[model samples]
Target: MIVGRRWGDAVDSWVKKMQSLVGYRTFTVLTIVITGLLLFLLLINGVRPEKYDIQEFHLSTETIRSIKTVEDPVKTEEERQRAASEVSSVYQFSEEIGENRAAIVTSVIDYVLEEKAESVESLAPMEEQVSDLKENLNVLETDGEGIRFTDGALVSLLLLENESLINLRDSLTASIRDIMSKPIRSEQVANTKNEIERRIRGNLEIPESVLPTAVLIGRYSINENETLNEELTQARIEQARASIEPTRILQGQVIVQEGQIIDREVYRQLKLLGMLTNQSSMKPILGLILFISLCMWLLHMQMTKWRASKEERQRTLLVVMLILIMSVIGMKLISLVSNNFDVSIAFLFPTALAPMLVRSLINERFAVLMAFLTAAIAGIVFQEGYSVVLQMEIALYLLFGGLAGLYVIQGAEKRSHLLQTSLSVAVVNFVFMAFYLLMTQSDYGVSELLFYGIAAITSGLLSGALTIGMLPFFESAFGLISTMKLIELSNPNHPLLKKILTETPGTYHHSVMVANLADAACESIGADGLLARVGCYYHDIGKTKRPGFFIENQMSHANPHDSLPPETSRDIILSHGSDGAKLLQKHKMPKEIIDIAEQHHGTSLLKYFYYKAKEEGQSVNEEDYRYAGPKPQKKETAIISIADSVEAAVRSMKHPTAEKIQEIVHSIIKDRLHDGQFDECDLTLKELKTVERVLCETLNGIFHSRIEYPQ
Candidate 1:
């Protein structure tokens, strides 16, 4: 035993040393990091494991599935490129060049014919004149290569009788101008040259030599007037690419069928779906770590940055992490089952269970944080090897379901209210799923819709059912006094409450009055009003143990304390505080309530009994006449202490009024403050003033005077 005790002591000492060394914030960070690492490890497997562990040629040992459906980036890119390529390239037309070339050719031909050269002797001068005309036109210079005339074409032009060359020139220039006026792309130059040649030969009765020259000139003059418009072509290609939607595989879609040969195409698909037979990659592991880290950071921010009390920060963080870990474990188990069975009903997991529990036992801000974190984790864990759309839908389901449960349970009272919340959450979930299906335009058979509907509804129902069943355990294990538990304990039907009402009715009424005062005062001071009220209800439960011994329950004016020894009476009164604490502990009440019961009357001297003993010629130790207490440690308990005293004092007044109540309350508060009763609690002077004002107002209302009616 000694060895075991020493070991336990050493372990506790080590824990204390570590806590002191690391400090609260550092300890919180380390805890969150450890939780994130564990969650990352749990979910890294769920994030479609690195390539299936199969050999290239080996028979498939197990059926491989994609965890989440994702877009085939390579295939989508290829398809987009092909679509872009199929778009015709844009071209810019230069009509100015075509018109200038037409003018040059026509002018050259006209100049040659107008010379009227007699024969071959004059042909040289005529050719010189044509060349001069070409130079004057300046169109050929733009082309950089001057047009060449066919053999005998110049002599044929000079020898042409009548207006033959002129007519041919006009015909060729018109055709060339018409063709070049529009966009003549690079690929169309040859066909256009041929068409011009044919038009010159057919439309004009020109000599064959002249026709060849006309064709050559037309082809040369045409040039590539229409150049490719790079900017416009690129814009069109981008537009076409934008029109093509990304091709993605749906979640749970088979990448490679069972027993199918893993050919190149299948292998590519497997690799894209993260099912290829390759070594584990750090990319996914890093991604999971980052995502879990982000969740932990959000949790930390909510805890440290929110309005949580300084003393409860560590405990709140611990509880939230514990709840989140449990939730993630539950989700991971469901994912494993879904993966193994290839079922789509993993959505039926009670994702809302944790959020509702957190909202109930902790704060709503933490619950909201848990809702978002749970959704983000679910998105990663429940990814289908199909498209991202399914993953988003799962996230939506978790978020809406958790939020619905959280909101529906707010202000809930009776046990049946929880069941009503379940139904309400089911309706909300149904609407969410229906909206998703409608927006996505997903085609579903009756059976498929029924399956999803059942899952959605079941998710909400299971969340409610699990939260209802698990709440008490968390409350009991963590010593958490949730509003629901407080309400239940406050019920008159409870055994302890019933015993108080039946055996000590006057004390019960006095407790109720104290509850009213404390509730109002606590609320006014920005403290927990419900907690104060509930604590006040149970603060005097021990008086029921010996009902008649207390003055409040003794209906007959004959005082039981008058007959007993002052020391005995003092012991009986002090024992009530301890007795009330023991009774509360026996009933498994929350510690806050027990503390209020035991500490409302701090370690103050029982002056009435002390003075009675002193007057009776008996020596009384002041320490023995005081109630043993640890003092009120929280704002709510401290407020209850002051409010209880004020209520009993005001009730005993002969003529109660607002001014009288105010003076008495201030005096009582001042006495408590001076006696160091409020020293242990963190309540501020400002809060105390607010409590005094609220109590004064409440007392005024309860004891307000009424006008007499006419007789």
Candidate 2:
């Protein structure tokens, strides 16, 4: 037993010595730097393109080839556009061309008829009428492609006199209007003119000379009336070419012959494949380093915003860095397996494991940040020179899965909760994966979908199992006091707590009241109430070693301290702080609880024993009656000290009132302040006043008067 005790002490001392050497700031900076370098190394190989320094070397394999068949997008688009532009232009027919020409021919005939009528009324000779009519119709001579009439046709018309010329004019106007009303192509103008002249000769009995001249005028007046419809024509062309398929180059095809020079086509294929080797440069490497550095810098800034203590921030960084490294390594291993077995096996990787662990064990924001970081790292670690689209999809899958895991474990408070959280995560994973597959419209067989579904489900369950198995190790290794661990320690069934309850019932009852007082007071001051409550439960555990000597456990009227010397009693009373700490240490309690036990009394004077010795004419040093302490180093421990004093002092009073409780609480705080017991802690004067008020209220409630029952 003695050897085991010494061994435990030695181990604890060694741990403390090692802990003292670790500088929080140095550890944080070093861990971040290491994490950045590791990320840069992992990602550089994937991000940096392979270059071939083929100074004189010939092609080894059939020049380079793309792993997957892909369309030459630029070439395909150009071909489609060229095909669309090849459609012929469309034209719209206009009717105004036929109408205006028919009107011009009627006007010339009307002018000739009017001149003849005037000559006849004046009783002029037929020759004079003919000459006058010819002179009046001469205006039509210069009109080409309009209403030009030849001299012979005019003379033939004058010979016909009034009736014949009028009939010819009506027939000519009707022929020109009917023929020119329909759409006329430029190439079909002659055929249309011939058809109109044929119609005039067959359907009407006009003179042949008049007929030929009328046909000439009709043909000349009828022009092509169709005009280009640009919008409609272009739309038709685009619709015709919209179904063109992209041209593609299949995988493993020869890009270039072995002995052929590296042309642009071959160079493009090699660059696309990323298979060229032996040529290295620093540009990609530097860019990768910069990217990793930026990520780490942003993570650091986020940590600063959290405002965690120096030591806590260091531990958090260390934990996150270690988890990220492990995640990256796991991804690389999984990728290797995927490369060897099935390429789809990479989807089975539980990228959420680390983030879930972080969420349960550390801060939620830290878990979320780590989720994003792990996703980025996994992208590089698992990439296999696939298309950019595929790479991005893989990264997004990991990111969503990690974030889902975090969301599941957001408010998890127990180990068993992880299993249920895992189920929720699995649901999220499957939903997201299904959405992704549908969104990308990737063709998949039933077996492929099933396989992906299984992988997604397995990721969640596996992550939860890993978190459950690993959390205890992390808690023990890092000396972390998680809420789960605190809950376990707070159980009344705990060995140390049960010992105090059974062996020192008075002290136990007193401790419970102190817990109430400390919990309320600490909460009011924004200190750790749970920690203070649990600390109070074990604060006076040393009193169990000598229950009869402490007044609280003395149920009988007789006092044990009456027979004991003041020096002896003082020694016993003062030793409880140290003794309680030792007992807690033997039970391997958390250091926080031990500190509360050891420092609650501080070095405050044992007033009763000191005054007793002084009244006896003994030259006792005042320091000799005080408990040994290193003082409270935190607000929780310091508040526990004040509550411990106030509880005991108030309980000793006969029928304590609210005003008396307030007075005693203030007195205890004042004495501690004057004695410098609070000097080592970060508790402020305002917090102390708040603590006093909370204690007064709590104590008043505990010792308040109750109504008498009717007997």
Candidate 3:
């Protein structure tokens, strides 16, 4: 409960902070988010489910396609209707129909037999006998209590012996009872009666003329025994309807062909899909605004991870914003053209190109953030429609491609190394495509594979080509010093380098040696080794201004410092740092290079000069002998300071063995540490120890493998 309360309090605090934001901070954030919204808005229009303008009977000018799969209600209803039509009606049977019909037939037979005993005592001719029996049975045919037979049938019965008449009665009665015992619907009544008559007549127990009388009597007595079951019949219809499968309209299915009339059913489908829009839709636009806001927040979090000044952060934001806008514009072009082809054009998008450009222009650390941001955008811009929240394949492939390109571009210090980035991104994209294929239970045709392959390769090549073309423009426009720029400046023929070589070759040699040492030490401590190496090359360029006054260029063994006052020599040495900074600034060198040229010495005392004046019995101030210092402000500059001091101190030793080199290296590093040369920078005591260990090892390698590095 306490933790929860604390969390709530923190959230409230954050909300308050956000509400209180003002001025430049608010402006910067607003600018980035609004710019992102405008860029991505171009993409959302194409990705949203295609809306149409039509009504129930309007004709369509173009083919209208479904952007997603949904159930087709009209087709589903037709299927259910077909299923219901096949269901037969149900009927209920009565259990007592058989006994009722049998009893009626028996009573008529008894009446006939009784009449035969009472009324017909004497024999008669056959015609008269048939006429008499027909008259007697006419009484049996009376309302609801009748057995009707023709004259031929009565004659056959009257002429039969007494035993045959009894047999006929039993047989007809049994047949009627059996036929009514099982289920029989009202529709089957006539067929049942005929079947009973056939059964009696086929037996041949009596003469053929007698057969007709038996068959007619049995046929007249049978009745309907079953009625229709309305409830059960309706239930069967429902069950059959439930068994049918619903039809679907798959994504990309054409609702109406080009130039076809928009029928009622198709219009309903379009309305159901939310495509028949008359008014403008603001939902996707609102959603895009929220999406871009979230992206800006993520970028802010990444920027916070790097501790930079407000100006630097603002600059980075604009750079990232420019790159993202370009990326979206690229995606928009691809989306527009994708409609012209059968295959998706998403694979041709150079999502990885953004990361490569950032990596080439900015430091690799910031490029990591760009990769994630680019991938997140791909998740949106490449989605199938507005309803699909994300497309995992395209998003993940972008992520993999961006990261692969970034990793490969890390070794790129020259323009030629960018080709490796193309190959790396292409390989990752292809592998991810194959992985998606194997994972999905779907098949791809040969033509589809060919299109996909071309798209992937095009994406890779585009990344490399765009990066190469954009780097020089960005560097010139932004005044940024990337590794490639730093490497270019380090070449021997550059004007500044040539000046030092021609005028002060001794200092040139010294600068090169310092470059090797600083590069090795900076790399060991995870500093910017390349920047340090390049900075070392130019740190002593000011020595060209007054060559002989500095001891390294005095080939005649003449000491200009000995002829001059201690203060004059101190002034000359101090002026070199500031003078070098001016030369670099005039040449429009990057600020980092100028900062290294200026801050490498810091404001430490020249104890030799300070003591020499005191020993000469002249009053001296320590500040006058010290270099004017705005100390080292970064890791590379700080390392260059240490490397510069140690390189000069160690080179003065007579027998520079492993132990002597360690002693002098440790002494100089400790002197710089105690004198507060590293105060302004964020280098820790532990990191300084690492620097100390690395320098000792590097110096030993330069001095012929003589010793131990600091443990």
Candidate 4:
């Protein structure tokens, strides 16, 4: 943003060369388009745009905030995993497995009791009976998951009483039925065997030694009755996954803090949000382009009212672009500061500066347009995040402030008037802020109110100060003839005016009288009276080169024209127009004043010397003695041309009565009309007659006859 002086000059020169090559309107359109592009870039950068790149588990070096609300997919997925883990795997309770296990246990118990009855009925030896029982216990491997027992445990079971055997069977059958009623996965088989063993030991009224035989019968009969249903377990998992809600990442949320490690979860979220991709969305760019195009279109329509010359149009457009670019940048800077600090200080933005400057340097319509422009841009720069329609609160307040400045800055033609206008703008700003706060239902204490009031006052005073400071620079740079510059040029103490007064007294007096007549005549014709008066003061500045050579400045009665050739005298008379133009240019006077000085005589012939050459029998051409002129191109210069000659010719009249003054004024206009001098300027016939009548009246007043007192 800080451009070097040499670089600035190079760019200025390049722009001027381009303007000359392309012409005014084409170059101005290009400038406006370029300005719109710049605004788009500035606004898009401010509109909640953030991106970052970070590897998983790496420490983040910067803090990042989200500009939109979206689901954190990574966290949501983690929650689903947890919910699924918390859900128990579903299993089926198989009634067929329970019935088979119960039948197996009853069959084993019947075999044990049959073994004891056979041993007692046969009166068999204890060893033979135990051996027979061990053989009998191995019924088949097909009963359940096939049962087995040790030889010692088979002997104890063969010795058990029948009553104890019946009790053991009942307890074992009931415990197995109750346990198999609930679902269980494959991992619970060993624990189920232990539960059956404990129940058999508690229910049997048998010897402790025979308890192992009874427990073995019960424990070995139980098998895996609850098998996992694959389809039903999968359904449960899916239900848990669906139950987890996605985690929402809200707008303005800080996704990462400095020095925080980007773990796998955070990394996934960043990827989902497009932060790590470094690829910005095309929506913001496309939207900004369309919006900016519309803004430039409005500007093109508004610029139709800028009434000026081609060069002035180019100059004013350049100034307008500068003011706009600077104003937007100022607003952007304020937005950045306020947003960063989280302060509610938007009222401090100096939104009125552009409108005041535009109104002062150009027309009020352009100022009004600029006010809307700044306000709309404020809407963009001050928005908290990306939105279809930006916040209108700040935009509306800015609009009122800018319009207030434009409305009151018209009275600020003088520096003293600027303070009064500033006061009015400040009051408007305060009232608007007050209305805005009340409308939005903002709660505030006295200190907060004071902050708002001070900021409002600052916005207004700053606008006025900046306008006054920059006006002179703009006028000088653009070669604009602003009213303040015109007033400064009209001062009697100006160096050019003093030079005319001191060096050529008679010409000075003549110029002043001519200025009065021209001023009065210009007023009557609806021309610039001030411009004509100022032009008359310096119209004859070239006479200072050789003051005595002209009749007005001649001290002695002896005519210098008597000795000099008529051609030489004619050359001296004709040289003042060009010389004055050159001198005024040297002093860097405005183009309008310089044009008046050069174009006033408008190629009218010096008849005195032309006829004198013919009388002396010297060969001469009539066109050769005429003043070199582009002619009067404006109304003020044409009126000054008539008044200049009118004052000079009538001053030579003897007994200058009102009748004679009117006759001479009429004669001067008739001569110029016949000579085609007023042909170029768009002065209507009625306006010329009015000029004629007003000049006569003014001359009559200056040269009125007075009654001499008898002494």
Q: Best candidate, lDDT-wise?
A: 4
Model 2 Cα lDDT, one tens digit per residue, 330-370:
88777766867643777787757888878766767888888
Clashes of each: 13, 0, 1, 0
The residue ranges of model 1 lying beyond 4 angstroms of the native Cα positions read: 1-27, 53-261, 265-274, 305-312, 339-343, 387-390, 433-453, 493-495, 498-506, 541-576, 603-628, 674-676, 679-686, 706-711
What ordering of candidates by TM-score runs from best to worst? 1, 2, 3, 4
lDDT of 1 by residue, 482-586 (tens): 888888888899888888899999999999999999999888867888999999899999898889888788887688887899988888898999999999877
TM-score of each: 0.72, 0.71, 0.70, 0.62
Residue 399 lDDT in model 1? 92
Better of 3 and 4 by lDDT: 4
Error of 2 at 215 (Å): 3.6
Q: Model 1 compared with the native: what TM-score?
A: 0.72
Q: What is the C-alpha lDDT of each candidate?
A: 0.78, 0.76, 0.78, 0.79
1 against 4, candidate with superior TM-score: 1
Residue 218, model 3: Cα distance from true site in angstroms: 15
